[model samples]
Target: MNSVTKARYDGLADWYDDRFVTGAEPHQPGLLELLGEGSGPCLDIGCGTGRNFETIRASGREVVGLDYSSDQLRLARTRTDGPLMVGDAAALPFPDESFDTVMVMWVSTDVDDFGAVVREAARVLRPGGVFVEYGVHPCFNGPHVVYNEDGGRTAHPTYRQSGWHEPAPWWGEDGIRRQIGMSHVPLADYLNAFLTAGLTVQRFIEPEGPPVPHSLAVRATKPA
Candidate 1:
């Protein structure tokens, strides 16, 4: 992400905790189940309001929430007693193999360098440690589609296009674009990033079930 994007998040930081996050995220059930118990520290990458911290902690692990926005970190501090750090996900400020579990939730859509973030996750995770990803379903959730009046999505030609997207006719006021530009990564790229980083997939979960699942949660582990 660029300085512009960071500025946008900082601008929304004050209201962010309330405006966007109402409660525990939708993918929590699948995410927690896949991540399983952790005896050591679990890094929460792009951990906006630290909503996932409680769940990670519940699984017998120390939680560390990391985000690039300082304002987000300030809000997160109130939610999580765990250490909150202002850091970039692309170039995480930690040594290699520093965590027992590296968990990312609701992040890839906002950041431009998705691959770098995945690589960083793999780098920090110890061998046999899990990398759990919980976020928008890449296949169906992209800049190319919008939820229709019938509760289904209407596909836009721009679906295959990947990169930063400004809020437009397809996604205006009520969407994330109203806050900051979003990055649309294809499904292949999403999985390939983990594979290239030397992590092997253990489980792939879709929280929304069938007929257009809005979210996905995946668990992969670094080879021991």
Candidate 2:
């Protein structure tokens, strides 16, 4: 995990889910279904506000939500009675092969060295376990792209990582302004991270939603 990312998320922790997780967010249900209501521990990396913890518990599995933000974890503590730790994604505090499944949702694109975090995910999952994630689509989000005429539009090259990152501003109806900050990792860079972590790519999908065309979703596995 990048130190900068940790700082930003920590600042946004308390209100993170409120701003992002709504009924219509893409990939939440799809990722949950892939987990299959299993009977094992689930590790949610970057578990902002513990939004997924309830769903994980409803499936009869123990849940551990880890994030680097005290503010966010404070809110998460209120949502579910589970272990919430402040930890780095690149160097998780847990041992290898500890979880049956690991979830990295919307956090991959926010790291500096994504491969480090992916490697950590692989190290902590049991054999045959699944690692699933959803992140910004690198295709539309690539660098070298320029926002044309504003209002959620941009142009970019066909490559990833090298693409520019231009996040939109946040101004709530309460007349307060929230700053826009972001981190970028191209699509290919993300896929390679999983491979380097000794995980096998099972599936990748571009989830459909509004405000944008697609969000990338992936399911990978560690061989038993």
TM-scores across all candidates? 0.93, 0.81
lDDT at residue 144 of model 2 (Cα atoms): 30
lDDT (Cα, tens digit) per residue for candidate 1, span 182-201 = 77888888888888899999
Model 2 clash pairs are 1-90, 142-163, 143-163, 143-164, 145-155, 161-186
Clashes of 1: 0
Output the lDDT of residue 152, model 1.
85
Candidate 1 ranges with C-alpha deviation above 4 Å: 24-27, 209-211
Measured by TM-score, the strongest candidate is 1
Q: How high is the CA lDDT of each candidate model? A: 0.80, 0.70
Give Cα distance to truth, residue 66, candidate 1, Å: 0.6
Model 1, residue pairs in steric clash: none
Give lDDT tens digits, candidate 2, residues 1-224. 45666566666653556666545343364666656667778899978777777667766678799887777788888877778898888889998889988988667556667788889999999999888876667655433333344436564443443422554332223211223254567666777888888998988877655455446878899999
